[model samples]
Target: MSPKEENNIRVLVTGGDGQLGKCIKVLEKDYPTLNLSFTSSKDLDITNKKNIAEFFKNNSLDYVINCAAYTNVEQAEKEPDKAYLVNAEGVKKLAEICKKYDATLIHISTDYVFDGYKNTPYIEEDVPNPINEYGKSKLKGEQYIQDILGEHFIIRTSWLYSQFGKNFYKTILQKSTTEEKLTITTSETGTPTNANDLAKFIINIIKSASSKYGIYNYSNLGESTWYSFAYEIVRISDKLDTRNLEKADNYFTLAERPTYSVLNKEKTLKTFPTSIENWKNSLSKLQNKMYDE
Candidate 1:
């Protein structure tokens, strides 16, 4: 085969309906060389081994971007089993299938894996001590991928939001329009990552096709508490005067969250030729995009 033919890659993205998945779909147009196939849960359920196996048998895949995850933090505490079923066991099955098919697995993880005991950012080598059921479940998924697949890139991100799906960014924007008073908590601290930025980064990794496979952290440059994030959103939307936004030291939540869960990106920076954007700048960009749309 010619060099161009050999370089042509077929990528399968699971959970194509999620925020990150939808962002990837939007950016797929830019990478014409990549043969990208997106699948929703209805089409390919990761939790079902037989379903995954059947899909893999019929399709030729070079890489599998596993975006399918159980992401409800508060609900996970109430139903830990449901979280593990998708986040852990489902991911384990996906990893095993990817290994069998000789395909590279690009899995999405969360910084919630850390307990947020340390004041500084968490690195790839930092031992994960998840405090919540959601975090624990995601950590188990990461562990499964590491144990089952050698060719994998497990990216752990934080506070992910975008123009699509149900996220904090959308929530704040929605609340600003409806609610007169908004009380956001300062209990948890983490970087608010733009899903579009992360989607681009993941696509860039696939384009590079580099063999440096392992866990990596990818988030926007800065950190903020939930209150600060909401304040910024209100400020940018010009809703500060009309809407009453208050900061609370603590808020009642079903799941106990980390006080700080910022992820270090030194490894991702050194490995990839991409620059990370600041949280505020990315958020502004998304806000503008939402307005334009």
Candidate 2:
């Protein structure tokens, strides 16, 4: 994007401290020509309807990328109300305010919306059959945006990790050095997406988002299980404990996962070329990037 076009951004990323949100913050340096703004969950609480409405009324925003959500999966089973409060009702406030202010809403969602039963890559049109509280809550958020706003993009991503924030990559890397035998679920499968890639894609779409306003699936182009992801972490980070490296030990998770939640890229590919990074390719590189800081 050109300097003038970039300046037209007037973009705001909610949940700016999150993995995806922090990634977007870093990308701002590349788009320095753009007039950008960021608000973490601390800066703006989406659950408060009035805070959102007042902010939109005051700012001249061109786009609102909402990365905020109550994202604890297994935790959501017990705190359904908390999940719905932020993921569902909180997003509703975003969509509603963005509509009133004439800014497009680019909302982040998840692949967990599908019940992991589809034998192939999930498409935008697949019937949503969320089996868990997290998925259902995110889907409810999407539904609010779709029903309330005329111009919106709901990007569904899965197995996401990044260097700047707490993620599966950091968790696995930390645990690998502590546990005698790590047990991760092998049957559950999904694509892992790098946060930087997601940020770049959003910036691209926002520059000319009139055409990219719709539901799209964006992630790294392959699939793997939590077990394999953990195994790869051990391979790259030699700091991993020696006790667990002799044999591969894994198990099922308490929360039922989408055995096949890989997302199709036909929609996003129509715009920016889809990322070619495999699940492991991105994971291996992220450890170095995270360790650098």
Candidate 3:
């Protein structure tokens, strides 16, 4: 075999139907040295150990990017057991399998792990004090990966959106067309991340084969409230006036979210050395891409 063929990396993306997974799929063609496989929960249920084991037995994997997660914060409050089953227990099983197979695991985490009590952006070293069930479950999953595996990259991101799946970006765009007035909350503060950029970052790590095994914070550079995000979305789509997007001080939610949960990307930038885009610019790019598609 040629040297390039010999050095090809094998990667499996779980929850392949998710926004992040689909975003990664869009970049699959760009990385010729990486052999990619995408599997939805129906195809490879991480919650089932035997199923994972059997699949691992058949396929030799170099890395596993786990995108499968129970992400509905409000629903997580009602079904803590289900959240833990997928986020914690399921992750533990996947980590164990990766360890057994000697494959590095790149697990996607959430900014919700932090309580959002701090005035500034959160760093990887900050103590995680989750305020809700979803955050708690995701934190537990991060713990499992840390304890069970030696080679792992735990990336914590916030407010992720993309062209492929249902997200706030799409919600705003849809609402702009139909709703005469939209009132969004300004109570919470966080960065809106473009999943396409995140997908590139993950692929870069794999391509570089960096052994910096630890947690990293990644998101767009700046922060914004839900109201600001919606405003920008409508403005970008040229429907702001028609939508009558208004800012509200409070919004009702079943789950308690961190008032502020922006992440510090200094560590990720210094480590990986990549250009991180501002949230507004990234949002515009995504909006343009959506229209083009």
Candidate 4:
């Protein structure tokens, strides 16, 4: 067989230090055709038009995987402006630059765009009715990207976590070790996506060179409550001292989350053919990684 043709697909990963970005970095070696450039918010502030222009002038990119987001749901309630600045306006700026540079954008979004009133899984065509600041900001970003560019993929995912960042997985692991008992809310429910899995999917799409550009939903195959997620983490860690409880309080959090926001992944699976693992199975793999560490 002849040597595989190098497409030399140049990709720019914003939020390079974030969980998903780190996962992409881990898998970079597997895709020899991809040449990736990672830039954190400090390196490339998406909100500042001048900064984005300057950076684009210096470097050329074929694709941009945008992971930078104002993700603090509760904090977003207090700092809505900051959230909009980063999540909405920043995304608009990035989309504009991508248009100017003729670059495709693969932007990360959230399942919180739904109001949780629907009993079934959310699809790509679902009308978004965001009830919180964070969700609204994210929806605005998605809108901007769609309006600005056609060569863009807006992937809406749920409950992304990894060992690399401050996510629910790391939080539960740390709490299980310190606290004697953990009381987590069961009212909210969503799929717990391993960032590594999502990262692999992104790279697979790039490698395929598919032009199936539009919004898609991706997450682990199953859904669970935060309480159940915590329990599994504690169990996998072999923490006998930790006790986990599922509780539902009216005012458990400053921000409201969807009681159920499982994303439908039919389009992504059909388009990319990436193997997706169940949430529990993915968690076990994460546990093995923790063990190795």
Candidate 5:
């Protein structure tokens, strides 16, 4: 690597307002050696092809981390076009731009790609059989990146929650403090990943690992259903409103979520010896960090 490649690597991060994106911003300050450009949808819209093309044409990026995605699981059924446009088409556009500039692409994906029928932790090689439009669109996005760009990483994470943005922590924290009762589904099972922890892991991959250009699975250390997760969060946050706790098992509502999608992290551990925080432990730490803020 030349001085340009070694001294100050230029990095472009999309979806800077999201959970993982915001965590990356917080963590980037530690690595002042890299020239980083963070942009939300307001600065650069990934859905527009011309806007994406112009961006790549102007900037010389060594790495492009894409945190943007159409994440509304239930709403995606009503707006399939928007989901496909942003999740599928938007990803395709970004991958193409990265290929044009010969930059490494780090794309985040979800565990919804699986049909939720599996009882074990999902690995990177698991065949994706998505049920909902959201899951299908994200799976399609993954395929596009793999086919279009060779030097790219597709990290499949599950039950991602962060203190920033509209995550499970914020939602449950607010509701627990106000609601007299709460009913959460007990069927779903996956590890709740802290955005900050995952961001640090991403940074580690970029720094230490060479040619880390493949699919990977990452999340917190343990697993639990959404119902259990909500309970634990409230219990930890003590200011939780314990007045309301009901069980809503009516899957007939609309979207039928996968029963389990806990990701297997053997690869990440074997490669980097990463210290992934446990769900409850990480949740407490994340809440404390936010309260301090």
Candidate 6:
């Protein structure tokens, strides 16, 4: 059944405790019409096919926002099997169930799926060549959804940060308390996405109930290097001066990152048309929220 035909859209969100999941939960009040069920990994293990089958058997759903993923890029290198088990195989399991139930699936993906060699913003149609295990696993999951089901939306985002989780924004804020100066990477560039912004966008998609099912890119409107992002976090918070920011070609990471992963949002803008905030403006708002918390 089409989601719009349902009297009440019963939506299920996996990875309920993650950053994006928390953002969705906070926005739940705004979307009272949706019967949203948030499920953590423990609440619903996506990797166990039998368990998922049982759960789907008991519950009826119209849509699913799959927030579950093994997002530790560096750690993914050490445990590619675990990454695939969750990101690829587990997602495949979810897609199959969604197909069986005739539910629309909305999957969160990453800009890391690309090799970051191109100088231009990445459109949805660009060929994905992931440099890291995490990206490869995510791409595999996307492929599974594409091959298995026609009713799905795969959103590829970059540099996701939020107040609710351990993200780069939080890390920078925490470091400012103890460390007088910070060194950040300037070689690599990508758009910083606020989880709340992405959450709201997802909700808009569900609310629109449009069947324009395909891949899309979503992130804050501008691009920045890690150094500039860190600088903005500190500057907006009024916690430190710009002199505290230092640039480095690289620090240390177990996984290799792309030099650029800025996603093109023209398609998304045409679809949703909500005002996309500049990364700095979003950061300032987040800083205020963090202070209030």
All candidates: TM-score: 0.96, 0.91, 0.96, 0.95, 0.94, 0.96
lDDT value, residue 263 of candidate 6: 97
lDDT of 2 by residue, 1-293 (tens): 12224446688889988888888887777776567788987789999989998887787787888999898888898889999999999999888888888888899999999998888999999989899888999999999999999889999998888787778877777777677776666777888788777888888777664555679998888887777676777888767753474333345445666678999987778766545567677776676674233
Output the lDDT of residue 242, model 2. Answer: 39
In model 1, the runs with Cα more than 4 Å from the true position are 1-7, 239-243, 290-293
TM-score comparison, 1 vs 5, better candidate: 1
Candidate with maximal lDDT? 3
Where model 4 places Cα greater than 4 Å from the true spot, the runs are 1-6, 240-246, 249-251, 290-293
User: What TM-score does candidate 6 reach?
Assistant: 0.96
Q: Report the C-alpha lDDT of model 3 over 110-200, residue by residue, as the tens digit.
A: 9999999999999999999999999999999999999999999999999999887899988888877888889899999999999999999
For residues 1-293, could you state the per-residue lDDT of candidate 5 as single tens digits?
12236658888989988888888998777988778889999888999989988888888788888999889988999999999999999999999988887889999999899998999988888899998999999999999999999988898888888767897778888877677777887767888888888888888777763686789988998999888788788776656644465666653536667888899999878877578878888888876775222
Candidate 5 TM-score to native: 0.94
lDDT of 5 at 26: 87
On residues 1-293, what C-alpha lDDT tens digit does candidate 4 reach at each position? Answer: 12223577788999998989999999988888898999999999999999998888888788899999899999999999999999999999999998998888999999999999998999999999998999999999999999999999999999998888799899888876777667788888899999998998898878887888999999999999887787787787766343454455443778888888999998888888687899999998988894222
Lowest-sum lDDT 10-residue window in model 4:
242-251
Q: For model 1, state the Cα shift of residue 36 in Å.
A: 0.9
Q: lDDT by residue for model 6 over 82-141, one digit each (tens)?
A: 999999999999999889988899999999999999999999999999999999999999
lDDT, model 3, position 147: 97
Candidate 2: where is the Cα deviation over 4 Å?
1-6, 241-254, 290-293
Error of 1 at 54 (Å): 0.9
- Model 2 vs. true fold: TM: 0.91
Tens digits of lDDT, candidate 1, 89-196: 999999999888888999999999999999999999999999999999999999999999999999999999998889998888897788788889988889999999
Worst 10 residues of 3 by lDDT: 1-10
